[model samples]
Target: MSAALALRQAIHDRLAADAPLAALAGAVRIHDVPPADVAFPFVILGEAVVADWSTATEGGTEQSLTLHAFSRAGGRREAFALAAAIQEALHDAPLALAGHRLANLRATTAEVRREGDGRTYHALVRFRAVTEPL
Candidate 1:
Protein backbone atom coordinates (compact mmCIF):
# COMPACT_ATOMS: atom_id res chain seq x y z
CA MET A 1 0.00 0.00 0.00
CA SER A 2 1.07 3.54 -0.64
CA ALA A 3 2.21 5.66 2.25
CA ALA A 4 -0.53 8.19 1.74
CA LEU A 5 -3.31 5.65 1.84
CA ALA A 6 -1.84 3.87 4.83
CA LEU A 7 -1.36 7.08 6.72
CA ARG A 8 -4.87 8.23 5.96
CA GLN A 9 -6.35 5.00 7.19
CA ALA A 10 -4.14 5.02 10.24
CA ILE A 11 -5.23 8.54 11.04
CA HIS A 12 -8.90 7.73 10.62
CA ASP A 13 -8.60 4.62 12.70
CA ARG A 14 -6.71 6.39 15.44
CA LEU A 15 -9.26 9.15 15.71
CA ALA A 16 -12.15 6.74 15.59
CA ALA A 17 -10.61 4.76 18.43
CA ASP A 18 -9.78 7.67 20.69
CA ALA A 19 -12.08 7.98 23.69
CA PRO A 20 -11.71 11.73 24.00
CA LEU A 21 -12.49 12.20 20.34
CA ALA A 22 -15.70 10.28 20.73
CA ALA A 23 -16.64 12.13 23.87
CA LEU A 24 -16.00 15.48 22.27
CA ALA A 25 -17.98 14.79 19.12
CA GLY A 26 -20.53 12.38 20.52
CA ALA A 27 -18.79 9.56 18.70
CA VAL A 28 -16.01 10.41 16.32
CA ARG A 29 -17.56 10.24 12.88
CA ILE A 30 -14.65 10.22 10.45
CA HIS A 31 -15.06 9.78 6.75
CA ASP A 32 -13.79 11.12 3.50
CA VAL A 33 -17.28 12.48 3.37
CA PRO A 34 -19.94 12.03 5.99
CA PRO A 35 -22.60 9.55 4.95
CA ALA A 36 -25.95 11.00 3.95
CA ASP A 37 -27.60 9.05 6.73
CA VAL A 38 -25.43 10.68 9.36
CA ALA A 39 -26.17 14.03 10.98
CA PHE A 40 -23.96 17.03 11.75
CA PRO A 41 -21.18 17.27 14.38
CA PHE A 42 -18.71 15.03 12.62
CA VAL A 43 -15.20 14.93 11.28
CA ILE A 44 -14.25 14.78 7.62
CA LEU A 45 -10.91 13.63 6.30
CA GLY A 46 -11.05 16.40 3.80
CA GLU A 47 -8.03 16.10 1.50
CA ALA A 48 -4.57 14.59 1.33
CA VAL A 49 -1.56 15.58 -0.72
CA VAL A 50 1.63 13.55 -0.76
CA ALA A 51 5.12 14.44 -1.90
CA ASP A 52 8.43 12.67 -2.08
CA TRP A 53 10.78 13.28 0.81
CA SER A 54 13.31 10.63 -0.03
CA THR A 55 16.92 10.55 0.93
CA ALA A 56 19.81 8.74 -0.75
CA THR A 57 19.20 5.45 1.01
CA GLU A 58 15.72 5.82 2.41
CA GLY A 59 12.33 6.35 0.84
CA GLY A 60 10.41 9.07 2.64
CA THR A 61 7.18 10.91 2.05
CA GLU A 62 5.53 13.98 3.43
CA GLN A 63 1.76 14.10 3.55
CA SER A 64 -0.48 17.03 4.16
CA LEU A 65 -3.91 16.18 5.45
CA THR A 66 -6.80 18.51 6.06
CA LEU A 67 -9.43 17.49 8.61
CA HIS A 68 -12.73 19.33 8.77
CA ALA A 69 -15.13 19.51 11.67
CA PHE A 70 -18.78 20.33 11.17
CA SER A 71 -21.20 21.05 13.95
CA ARG A 72 -24.59 22.64 14.66
CA ALA A 73 -24.08 23.69 18.25
CA GLY A 74 -25.50 27.20 17.66
CA GLY A 75 -22.01 28.66 17.28
CA ARG A 76 -18.38 28.05 16.40
CA ARG A 77 -17.49 26.97 19.92
CA GLU A 78 -18.53 23.38 19.48
CA ALA A 79 -16.70 23.06 16.19
CA PHE A 80 -13.59 24.57 17.71
CA ALA A 81 -13.78 22.20 20.64
CA LEU A 82 -13.97 19.25 18.32
CA ALA A 83 -11.01 20.58 16.38
CA ALA A 84 -8.97 20.77 19.56
CA ALA A 85 -9.72 17.17 20.34
CA ILE A 86 -8.65 16.19 16.86
CA GLN A 87 -5.40 18.09 17.15
CA GLU A 88 -4.60 16.56 20.46
CA ALA A 89 -5.41 13.13 19.16
CA LEU A 90 -3.13 13.43 16.14
CA HIS A 91 -0.21 15.56 17.25
CA ASP A 92 2.85 13.35 17.51
CA ALA A 93 0.51 10.41 17.47
CA PRO A 94 2.12 6.99 17.23
CA LEU A 95 0.38 5.69 14.16
CA ALA A 96 0.95 2.16 13.00
CA LEU A 97 0.99 2.08 9.22
CA ALA A 98 1.00 -1.25 7.43
CA GLY A 99 3.82 -0.56 4.97
CA HIS A 100 5.32 2.53 6.42
CA ARG A 101 6.64 4.03 9.62
CA LEU A 102 5.19 7.24 10.91
CA ALA A 103 8.23 9.37 11.55
CA ASN A 104 6.25 12.30 12.82
CA LEU A 105 2.85 13.89 12.76
CA ARG A 106 2.07 17.41 13.82
CA ALA A 107 -0.89 19.69 13.75
CA THR A 108 -0.04 22.67 11.60
CA THR A 109 -2.98 25.01 11.95
CA ALA A 110 -6.63 25.20 12.84
CA GLU A 111 -9.18 27.78 11.80
CA VAL A 112 -12.82 28.24 12.70
CA ARG A 113 -15.23 29.87 10.34
CA ARG A 114 -18.98 30.20 10.25
CA GLU A 115 -20.24 28.61 7.11
CA GLY A 116 -22.07 30.85 4.69
CA ASP A 117 -25.09 28.62 5.14
CA GLY A 118 -25.24 30.17 8.62
CA ARG A 119 -26.36 26.99 10.28
CA THR A 120 -23.07 25.15 10.40
CA TYR A 121 -19.63 25.83 11.76
CA HIS A 122 -16.61 24.72 9.78
CA ALA A 123 -13.37 24.02 11.55
CA LEU A 124 -10.36 23.07 9.50
CA VAL A 125 -7.25 21.40 10.93
CA ARG A 126 -4.13 20.99 8.86
CA PHE A 127 -1.65 18.22 9.70
CA ARG A 128 1.82 17.48 8.42
CA ALA A 129 2.98 13.87 8.63
CA VAL A 130 6.21 12.27 7.53
CA THR A 131 6.56 8.60 6.78
CA GLU A 132 9.20 6.18 5.61
CA PRO A 133 9.14 2.66 4.34
CA LEU A 134 9.21 -0.03 6.99
Candidate 2:
Protein backbone atom coordinates (compact mmCIF):
# COMPACT_ATOMS: atom_id res chain seq x y z
CA MET A 1 0.00 0.00 0.00
CA SER A 2 1.04 3.61 -0.40
CA ALA A 3 2.64 5.25 2.62
CA ALA A 4 -0.22 7.69 3.02
CA LEU A 5 -2.82 4.93 2.97
CA ALA A 6 -0.84 2.84 5.42
CA LEU A 7 -0.44 5.75 7.76
CA ARG A 8 -4.13 6.58 7.61
CA GLN A 9 -5.12 3.00 8.39
CA ALA A 10 -2.74 2.89 11.31
CA ILE A 11 -4.13 6.13 12.70
CA HIS A 12 -7.71 4.97 12.39
CA ASP A 13 -6.93 1.70 14.13
CA ARG A 14 -5.16 3.46 16.94
CA LEU A 15 -8.00 5.87 17.51
CA ALA A 16 -10.59 3.11 17.40
CA ALA A 17 -8.70 1.11 20.00
CA ASP A 18 -8.14 4.03 22.35
CA ALA A 19 -10.22 3.41 25.46
CA PRO A 20 -10.05 6.91 26.81
CA LEU A 21 -11.15 8.40 23.53
CA ALA A 22 -13.99 5.91 23.31
CA ALA A 23 -15.13 6.96 26.75
CA LEU A 24 -15.32 10.58 25.70
CA ALA A 25 -16.85 10.14 22.28
CA GLY A 26 -18.61 6.83 22.80
CA ALA A 27 -17.73 3.54 21.19
CA VAL A 28 -18.26 3.36 17.41
CA ARG A 29 -18.53 7.14 17.12
CA ILE A 30 -15.28 7.56 15.23
CA HIS A 31 -15.78 7.25 11.47
CA ASP A 32 -14.23 7.85 8.09
CA VAL A 33 -17.63 9.13 6.95
CA PRO A 34 -20.17 9.64 9.64
CA PRO A 35 -23.78 8.71 9.05
CA ALA A 36 -26.35 11.40 8.38
CA ASP A 37 -27.83 10.96 11.83
CA VAL A 38 -24.61 10.42 13.72
CA ALA A 39 -24.49 11.19 17.41
CA PHE A 40 -22.97 14.21 19.09
CA PRO A 41 -19.37 14.46 20.32
CA PHE A 42 -18.31 12.16 17.50
CA VAL A 43 -15.05 12.17 15.57
CA ILE A 44 -14.63 12.08 11.80
CA LEU A 45 -11.53 11.40 9.82
CA GLY A 46 -11.22 14.41 7.53
CA GLU A 47 -9.00 15.41 4.67
CA ALA A 48 -5.51 14.11 3.97
CA VAL A 49 -2.86 15.73 1.80
CA VAL A 50 0.18 13.72 0.79
CA ALA A 51 3.35 14.82 -0.92
CA ASP A 52 6.36 12.96 -2.20
CA TRP A 53 9.38 13.33 0.06
CA SER A 54 11.71 10.82 -1.50
CA THR A 55 15.42 11.23 -1.36
CA ALA A 56 17.95 10.06 -3.94
CA THR A 57 18.35 6.76 -2.12
CA GLU A 58 15.03 6.25 -0.37
CA GLY A 59 11.35 6.75 -1.09
CA GLY A 60 9.20 8.57 1.44
CA THR A 61 6.11 10.64 1.88
CA GLU A 62 4.89 13.54 3.98
CA GLN A 63 1.26 13.64 4.99
CA SER A 64 -1.14 16.10 6.52
CA LEU A 65 -4.15 14.49 8.24
CA THR A 66 -7.12 16.26 9.70
CA LEU A 67 -9.68 14.99 12.23
CA HIS A 68 -12.93 16.67 13.09
CA ALA A 69 -14.89 16.56 16.30
CA PHE A 70 -18.54 17.61 16.33
CA SER A 71 -20.66 18.43 19.31
CA ARG A 72 -24.04 19.96 19.94
CA ALA A 73 -23.36 20.91 23.51
CA GLY A 74 -24.37 24.26 24.92
CA GLY A 75 -20.79 25.55 24.77
CA ARG A 76 -17.46 25.02 23.08
CA ARG A 77 -16.19 23.02 26.02
CA GLU A 78 -17.20 19.64 24.60
CA ALA A 79 -15.62 20.31 21.23
CA PHE A 80 -12.41 21.54 22.82
CA ALA A 81 -12.25 18.54 25.10
CA LEU A 82 -12.67 16.18 22.15
CA ALA A 83 -9.95 17.98 20.22
CA ALA A 84 -7.57 17.72 23.18
CA ALA A 85 -8.22 14.01 23.49
CA ILE A 86 -7.55 13.49 19.79
CA GLN A 87 -4.30 15.41 20.03
CA GLU A 88 -3.19 13.43 23.04
CA ALA A 89 -4.07 10.20 21.27
CA LEU A 90 -2.27 10.97 18.01
CA HIS A 91 0.60 13.36 18.69
CA ASP A 92 3.86 11.41 18.61
CA ALA A 93 1.91 8.18 18.56
CA PRO A 94 3.92 5.13 17.57
CA LEU A 95 1.63 3.74 14.91
CA ALA A 96 2.68 0.70 12.90
CA LEU A 97 1.94 1.24 9.26
CA ALA A 98 1.42 -1.57 6.80
CA GLY A 99 4.41 -2.01 4.49
CA HIS A 100 5.74 1.31 5.73
CA ARG A 101 7.74 2.80 8.56
CA LEU A 102 6.28 5.66 10.48
CA ALA A 103 9.19 8.05 10.83
CA ASN A 104 7.31 10.73 12.75
CA LEU A 105 3.87 11.98 13.71
CA ARG A 106 2.81 15.15 15.48
CA ALA A 107 -0.17 17.35 16.01
CA THR A 108 0.44 20.55 14.06
CA THR A 109 -2.66 22.70 14.56
CA ALA A 110 -6.11 22.73 16.13
CA GLU A 111 -9.16 24.96 15.94
CA VAL A 112 -12.47 24.96 17.74
CA ARG A 113 -15.38 27.08 16.62
CA ARG A 114 -19.13 27.38 16.59
CA GLU A 115 -20.51 26.38 13.23
CA GLY A 116 -22.72 28.65 11.13
CA ASP A 117 -25.74 26.63 12.17
CA GLY A 118 -25.15 28.24 15.57
CA ARG A 119 -26.06 25.14 17.56
CA THR A 120 -23.16 22.88 16.66
CA TYR A 121 -19.52 23.21 17.61
CA HIS A 122 -16.71 21.92 15.46
CA ALA A 123 -13.15 21.10 16.42
CA LEU A 124 -10.50 20.42 13.83
CA VAL A 125 -7.14 18.89 14.68
CA ARG A 126 -4.44 18.50 12.08
CA PHE A 127 -1.41 16.20 12.17
CA ARG A 128 1.79 15.87 10.17
CA ALA A 129 3.55 12.60 9.49
CA VAL A 130 6.49 11.21 7.57
CA THR A 131 6.72 7.66 6.32
CA GLU A 132 9.11 5.48 4.38
CA PRO A 133 8.97 2.11 2.73
CA LEU A 134 9.85 -0.70 5.08
Candidate 3:
Protein backbone atom coordinates (compact mmCIF):
# COMPACT_ATOMS: atom_id res chain seq x y z
CA MET A 1 0.00 0.00 0.00
CA SER A 2 1.00 3.60 -0.44
CA ALA A 3 2.55 5.49 2.45
CA ALA A 4 -0.42 7.85 2.41
CA LEU A 5 -2.80 4.93 2.79
CA ALA A 6 -0.77 3.35 5.57
CA LEU A 7 -0.64 6.68 7.31
CA ARG A 8 -4.40 6.90 7.21
CA GLN A 9 -4.81 3.48 8.82
CA ALA A 10 -2.18 4.19 11.46
CA ILE A 11 -3.97 7.39 12.38
CA HIS A 12 -7.32 5.67 12.66
CA ASP A 13 -5.97 2.85 14.80
CA ARG A 14 -4.16 5.27 17.04
CA LEU A 15 -7.16 7.57 17.46
CA ALA A 16 -9.65 4.77 17.98
CA ALA A 17 -7.43 3.18 20.58
CA ASP A 18 -6.63 6.38 22.44
CA ALA A 19 -8.91 7.84 25.09
CA PRO A 20 -7.09 11.15 25.50
CA LEU A 21 -7.56 11.63 21.77
CA ALA A 22 -10.27 14.17 22.45
CA ALA A 23 -7.66 16.41 24.06
CA LEU A 24 -4.69 15.63 21.83
CA ALA A 25 -6.62 16.25 18.64
CA GLY A 26 -5.90 19.92 19.07
CA ALA A 27 -2.17 19.55 18.58
CA VAL A 28 -2.23 17.48 15.37
CA ARG A 29 -0.79 18.68 12.11
CA ILE A 30 -0.08 16.35 9.22
CA HIS A 31 2.39 17.04 6.45
CA ASP A 32 3.48 15.58 3.17
CA VAL A 33 5.86 12.66 3.28
CA PRO A 34 9.04 14.27 2.18
CA PRO A 35 12.28 12.51 1.32
CA ALA A 36 13.78 14.19 4.36
CA ASP A 37 13.26 13.12 7.90
CA VAL A 38 10.19 14.07 9.92
CA ALA A 39 9.80 14.01 13.66
CA PHE A 40 6.76 13.54 15.85
CA PRO A 41 6.52 14.55 19.50
CA PHE A 42 4.95 11.56 21.15
CA VAL A 43 4.25 11.09 24.85
CA ILE A 44 4.68 7.76 26.51
CA LEU A 45 3.70 7.06 30.13
CA GLY A 46 3.44 10.83 30.58
CA GLU A 47 6.91 11.44 29.15
CA ALA A 48 7.59 13.06 25.79
CA VAL A 49 9.51 11.30 23.04
CA VAL A 50 10.30 12.26 19.47
CA ALA A 51 9.28 9.75 16.79
CA ASP A 52 11.35 10.19 13.68
CA TRP A 53 10.48 9.39 10.02
CA SER A 54 13.54 8.05 8.29
CA THR A 55 12.76 4.97 6.21
CA ALA A 56 11.51 5.48 2.67
CA THR A 57 10.72 3.11 -0.22
CA GLU A 58 12.25 3.06 -3.67
CA GLY A 59 9.30 5.15 -4.84
CA GLY A 60 10.65 8.01 -2.73
CA THR A 61 8.00 7.45 -0.09
CA GLU A 62 8.69 6.93 3.61
CA GLN A 63 6.82 4.62 5.94
CA SER A 64 9.29 4.21 8.77
CA LEU A 65 8.70 6.43 11.76
CA THR A 66 11.76 8.61 12.20
CA LEU A 67 10.89 9.19 15.85
CA HIS A 68 11.94 6.54 18.28
CA ALA A 69 9.17 5.22 20.53
CA PHE A 70 10.02 3.44 23.75
CA SER A 71 8.12 0.47 25.00
CA ARG A 72 5.45 1.35 27.58
CA ALA A 73 2.38 -0.45 28.78
CA GLY A 74 -0.98 1.33 28.79
CA GLY A 75 -1.38 5.03 27.96
CA ARG A 76 -1.56 3.96 24.31
CA ARG A 77 -4.67 6.10 24.13
CA GLU A 78 -2.65 9.27 24.49
CA ALA A 79 -0.04 8.18 22.00
CA PHE A 80 -2.51 6.91 19.43
CA ALA A 81 -4.69 9.97 19.72
CA LEU A 82 -1.77 12.33 19.30
CA ALA A 83 -0.46 10.45 16.30
CA ALA A 84 -3.86 10.21 14.59
CA ALA A 85 -4.76 13.84 15.06
CA ILE A 86 -1.41 14.96 13.70
CA GLN A 87 -1.73 12.66 10.70
CA GLU A 88 -5.23 13.83 9.87
CA ALA A 89 -4.15 17.43 9.93
CA LEU A 90 -1.15 16.77 7.70
CA HIS A 91 -3.02 14.70 5.11
CA ASP A 92 -5.50 17.50 4.78
CA ALA A 93 -2.75 20.10 4.69
CA PRO A 94 -3.03 22.65 1.92
CA LEU A 95 0.67 22.77 1.19
CA ALA A 96 0.79 19.02 0.84
CA LEU A 97 -2.44 17.83 -0.65
CA ALA A 98 -3.10 21.30 -2.09
CA GLY A 99 -6.22 21.68 -4.25
CA HIS A 100 -7.14 18.14 -3.34
CA ARG A 101 -7.21 18.64 0.42
CA LEU A 102 -10.87 17.78 0.97
CA ALA A 103 -10.97 15.34 -1.86
CA ASN A 104 -7.88 13.45 -0.75
CA LEU A 105 -9.27 12.69 2.69
CA ARG A 106 -10.46 9.12 3.02
CA ALA A 107 -13.27 8.61 5.49
CA THR A 108 -13.04 4.88 4.96
CA THR A 109 -10.05 2.75 5.98
CA ALA A 110 -6.57 4.21 6.52
CA GLU A 111 -3.47 3.52 4.42
CA VAL A 112 -0.91 1.20 6.01
CA ARG A 113 2.11 -0.66 4.62
CA ARG A 114 5.08 -2.50 6.09
CA GLU A 115 8.53 -1.82 4.73
CA GLY A 116 12.25 -2.25 5.54
CA ASP A 117 13.76 -5.04 7.60
CA GLY A 118 10.48 -5.91 9.32
CA ARG A 119 11.10 -3.08 11.75
CA THR A 120 9.32 -0.12 10.16
CA TYR A 121 5.89 0.88 8.86
CA HIS A 122 4.51 3.76 6.86
CA ALA A 123 1.16 5.44 6.18
CA LEU A 124 0.03 7.71 3.39
CA VAL A 125 -2.41 9.87 5.33
CA ARG A 126 -1.52 13.40 6.45
CA PHE A 127 -3.42 16.07 8.38
CA ARG A 128 -3.13 19.43 10.25
CA ALA A 129 -4.83 20.49 13.47
CA VAL A 130 -5.60 23.33 15.91
CA THR A 131 -6.94 21.85 19.11
CA GLU A 132 -10.64 21.02 18.79
CA PRO A 133 -13.02 23.14 16.83
CA LEU A 134 -14.21 25.21 19.72
Candidate 4:
Protein backbone atom coordinates (compact mmCIF):
# COMPACT_ATOMS: atom_id res chain seq x y z
CA MET A 1 0.00 0.00 0.00
CA SER A 2 1.00 3.62 -0.44
CA ALA A 3 2.46 5.35 2.56
CA ALA A 4 -0.47 7.71 2.83
CA LEU A 5 -2.97 4.87 2.74
CA ALA A 6 -1.01 2.91 5.27
CA LEU A 7 -0.78 5.86 7.59
CA ARG A 8 -4.48 6.54 7.30
CA GLN A 9 -5.36 2.92 8.05
CA ALA A 10 -3.08 2.86 11.03
CA ILE A 11 -4.59 6.04 12.36
CA HIS A 12 -8.14 4.82 11.92
CA ASP A 13 -7.37 1.55 13.61
CA ARG A 14 -5.71 3.30 16.51
CA LEU A 15 -8.62 5.65 17.00
CA ALA A 16 -11.19 2.93 16.65
CA ALA A 17 -9.42 0.81 19.21
CA ASP A 18 -8.99 3.54 21.81
CA ALA A 19 -11.25 2.96 24.79
CA PRO A 20 -11.11 6.51 26.04
CA LEU A 21 -11.99 7.90 22.65
CA ALA A 22 -14.81 5.44 22.28
CA ALA A 23 -16.16 6.50 25.65
CA LEU A 24 -16.23 10.10 24.56
CA ALA A 25 -17.46 9.58 21.02
CA GLY A 26 -19.30 6.26 21.44
CA ALA A 27 -18.56 2.94 19.82
CA VAL A 28 -18.30 2.92 16.00
CA ARG A 29 -18.87 6.66 15.89
CA ILE A 30 -15.56 7.19 14.12
CA HIS A 31 -16.07 6.71 10.42
CA ASP A 32 -14.41 7.11 7.02
CA VAL A 33 -17.82 7.79 5.51
CA PRO A 34 -20.50 8.39 8.06
CA PRO A 35 -23.89 6.88 7.49
CA ALA A 36 -26.73 9.09 6.32
CA ASP A 37 -28.58 8.75 9.62
CA VAL A 38 -25.52 9.13 11.78
CA ALA A 39 -25.95 10.80 15.14
CA PHE A 40 -24.27 13.91 16.44
CA PRO A 41 -21.13 14.02 18.58
CA PHE A 42 -19.27 11.76 16.13
CA VAL A 43 -15.93 11.85 14.38
CA ILE A 44 -15.23 11.79 10.66
CA LEU A 45 -11.97 10.90 9.01
CA GLY A 46 -11.73 13.87 6.72
CA GLU A 47 -9.32 14.90 4.02
CA ALA A 48 -5.74 13.82 3.51
CA VAL A 49 -2.96 15.32 1.40
CA VAL A 50 0.27 13.54 0.55
CA ALA A 51 3.56 14.80 -0.86
CA ASP A 52 6.92 13.37 -1.68
CA TRP A 53 9.62 13.48 0.96
CA SER A 54 12.06 11.26 -0.86
CA THR A 55 15.80 11.41 -0.57
CA ALA A 56 18.43 10.23 -3.01
CA THR A 57 18.78 6.89 -1.25
CA GLU A 58 15.36 6.35 0.32
CA GLY A 59 11.70 6.94 -0.46
CA GLY A 60 9.55 8.83 2.01
CA THR A 61 6.27 10.68 2.23
CA GLU A 62 4.77 13.55 4.17
CA GLN A 63 1.10 13.54 4.97
CA SER A 64 -1.42 16.03 6.26
CA LEU A 65 -4.50 14.46 7.83
CA THR A 66 -7.64 16.16 9.04
CA LEU A 67 -10.26 14.68 11.38
CA HIS A 68 -13.54 16.31 12.24
CA ALA A 69 -15.57 16.15 15.43
CA PHE A 70 -19.20 17.18 15.36
CA SER A 71 -21.45 17.89 18.28
CA ARG A 72 -24.86 19.36 18.82
CA ALA A 73 -24.49 20.01 22.49
CA GLY A 74 -25.54 23.32 24.02
CA GLY A 75 -21.95 24.60 23.67
CA ARG A 76 -18.58 23.85 22.17
CA ARG A 77 -17.38 21.87 25.15
CA GLU A 78 -18.22 18.50 23.68
CA ALA A 79 -16.52 19.22 20.40
CA PHE A 80 -13.41 20.56 22.07
CA ALA A 81 -13.26 17.59 24.40
CA LEU A 82 -13.40 15.18 21.48
CA ALA A 83 -10.67 17.08 19.67
CA ALA A 84 -8.44 16.95 22.73
CA ALA A 85 -8.96 13.22 23.10
CA ILE A 86 -8.06 12.71 19.47
CA GLN A 87 -4.89 14.74 19.83
CA GLU A 88 -3.85 12.86 22.92
CA ALA A 89 -4.46 9.55 21.19
CA LEU A 90 -2.40 10.40 18.10
CA HIS A 91 0.31 12.85 19.07
CA ASP A 92 3.62 11.00 18.87
CA ALA A 93 1.76 7.71 18.72
CA PRO A 94 3.81 4.66 17.80
CA LEU A 95 1.64 3.49 14.96
CA ALA A 96 2.76 0.52 12.90
CA LEU A 97 2.14 1.26 9.27
CA ALA A 98 1.79 -1.45 6.68
CA GLY A 99 4.92 -1.72 4.52
CA HIS A 100 6.24 1.54 5.98
CA ARG A 101 7.81 3.03 9.04
CA LEU A 102 6.12 5.84 10.87
CA ALA A 103 8.81 8.41 11.42
CA ASN A 104 6.70 10.91 13.33
CA LEU A 105 3.14 11.91 14.02
CA ARG A 106 2.00 15.09 15.70
CA ALA A 107 -1.15 17.02 16.16
CA THR A 108 -0.52 20.23 14.24
CA THR A 109 -3.63 22.34 14.83
CA ALA A 110 -7.15 22.26 16.15
CA GLU A 111 -9.97 24.70 15.42
CA VAL A 112 -13.37 24.62 17.07
CA ARG A 113 -16.28 26.72 15.94
CA ARG A 114 -20.00 26.78 15.64
CA GLU A 115 -21.29 25.91 12.24
CA GLY A 116 -23.47 28.24 10.15
CA ASP A 117 -26.52 26.27 11.18
CA GLY A 118 -25.82 27.80 14.60
CA ARG A 119 -26.60 24.66 16.56
CA THR A 120 -23.80 22.38 15.48
CA TYR A 121 -20.28 22.72 16.75
CA HIS A 122 -17.39 21.51 14.63
CA ALA A 123 -13.84 20.78 15.58
CA LEU A 124 -11.23 20.29 12.92
CA VAL A 125 -8.05 18.59 14.10
CA ARG A 126 -5.05 18.35 11.80
CA PHE A 127 -2.04 16.07 12.07
CA ARG A 128 1.29 15.97 10.28
CA ALA A 129 3.19 12.75 9.73
CA VAL A 130 6.20 11.37 7.93
CA THR A 131 6.68 7.83 6.70
CA GLU A 132 9.53 5.94 5.12
CA PRO A 133 9.39 2.68 3.21
CA LEU A 134 10.33 -0.31 5.28
Best by TM-score: 1
Candidate 4 has which clashing residue pairs, if any? none
Q: Cα RMSD (Å) per model?
A: 0.9, 1.0, 13.9, 1.0
Q: lDDT for model 2, on a 0 to 1 scale? A: 0.89
Question: TM-scores of the models, in the given order?
Answer: 0.96, 0.95, 0.25, 0.95
lDDT of 3 by residue, 13-122 (tens): 45445444445533323333322443333322111122223345312232222221211223344344344554453343332221112223222223434445343343
Angstrom error at residue 56, model 2: 0.5
Model 4 Cα RMSD, Å?
A: 1.0
Q: Show where candidate 3 strays beyond 4 Å.
A: 1-29, 33-35, 40-106, 125-134
Clashes of each: 0, 0, 37, 0
Error of 3 at 18 (Å): 14
Q: How do the residues 1-134 of candidate 2 rate in per-residue lDDT, one tens digit apiece?
A: 88877887888888888887888777637788988988787888889999999999999999999999999988899888889889998999989999999999999999999999999999999999999899
Q: Tell me how candidate 4 scores on lDDT.
A: 0.91
Residues 1-134 of candidate 1: C-alpha lDDT, one tens digit per residue: 99998998998899999998788787778889678887778889889899999999889999999999999999988998999999999999998999899999999999999988998999999999999998
Q: Give, for candidate 1, the lowest lDDT window spanning 10 residues.
A: 25-34
User: Local distance difference test, per candidate?
Assistant: 0.91, 0.89, 0.33, 0.91
User: What is the lDDT, from 0 to 100, of the residue 91 in candidate 2?
Assistant: 93
